[model samples]
Target: MSSRSTYHHGDLRQAVLSAALDVIATEGPSALSLRDLARRAGVSHAAPAHHFKDRAGLLTAVATEGFDLLAAALAQAKDLKDAGVRYVRFATEHPAHFQVMFQPDLHRPDDPELLAAKERAGAGLRAGIAGVPADGRGPDARLAGVAAWSLAHGFATLLLSHNLAGPIGEQDPEEVFRTLAGLLFTSDTAQPPQE
Candidate 1:
């Protein structure tokens, strides 16, 4: 049987998405092409376009999937620190997704599904920091959430870029993130931050 006949109806979309992820993981998002993904998935060149419309549509789907995955990961965390570590873990684990999810220019920023997924991920991130008490002179809950996100994102980017290999020296990325979180966010759970 031909490879094109292997994919059932819905399977082709996922196969294409998976192929896109593989390409992004190996060569970065710039390497992704609908034609290339279709070839990788063993489907006709028009198959991917049918599902994704074009490259931006394909990337938008990838970003949406990434956010959904991130939201799920964040939802599993026990606390802010755990969430931060999980965020880093998600980035390292889904480097291609991570790379595309943040680059609005690469995907259709106005896409409804993408916007919703982004909100879900943002809500998950905010919920992670919701219980933490703000230092009297520190930021409000909103700012605290932003700070937490920045810290995790920066660390993840460094790790993905291999910039942490020297300073971290093979130390577990998650553990390093946990330690970093501890240093930054006090264990004491005083009153939660003001809105």
Candidate 2:
């Protein structure tokens, strides 16, 4: 098939991307295919190949888009606590994107757009760490930052996977996260338990 797009529909590229996301959300990423996406987007079978060389290229594009969205979420945070909450929110809101973004084997990590977006997201995470006040007694900022991220990411992962509902009891995930954030912000060294 020619590299040129065969789609005459409006925003065919975006439509395909949206369809890919829908498929990922419903059937998981393993079931995604260019022909399937084309059918979902109401485009020719070769149209997706024109926009994306293959499945990996399409996944790379999705990962890049995901990182851009994550960066935006982190940038909107008011402080470290807010950043943690936002991180969980982003993961929960974009489960399909979050899944593909972390699975490097599924996409081309060296792609220019992917690299830039990853850098932007990393910068946003680091900026949130920078906003926290330096603690006395030789607190390691890098360690603290990692710990903060681990807590939020772990919690979000558990919530998404339905592993937290039992422990969460009557409290929602966001409420539990808010309490956890308060503790982290108030303590000099706060780390969630490993289970």
**Candidate 1: stretches off by over 4 Å:** 1-10, 189-195
RMSD of candidate 2 to the true fold? 4.9
Q: Compared with the true structure, what per-residue lDDT tens digits does model 1 show for residues 55-165? A: 999999999999999999999988999999889999989999999999999999999999999999998898888878755777888888888999999999999999999
For model 2, residues 1-195, the per-residue Cα lDDT tens digits are: 333444677888899899999988888899999998998887789888888889999999999999999999999987788888898999999998988998999999999999999999888888778866664644577887888888998998898888987899778677789899787765355455589
Report residue 53 deviation for candidate 2 (angstroms).
0.8
In model 2, which regions exceed 4 Å deviation? 1-6, 136-139, 187-195
- The CA lDDT at 184 in model 1 is 81
Instruction: Name the top TM-score candidate.
Output: 1
Task: State each model's C-alpha RMSD to the native.
Answer: 3.8, 4.9
Q: Model 2 TM-score?
A: 0.88
For each candidate, give its TM-score against the true structure.
Answer: 0.91, 0.88
How does residue 13 of candidate 2 score in lDDT? 83
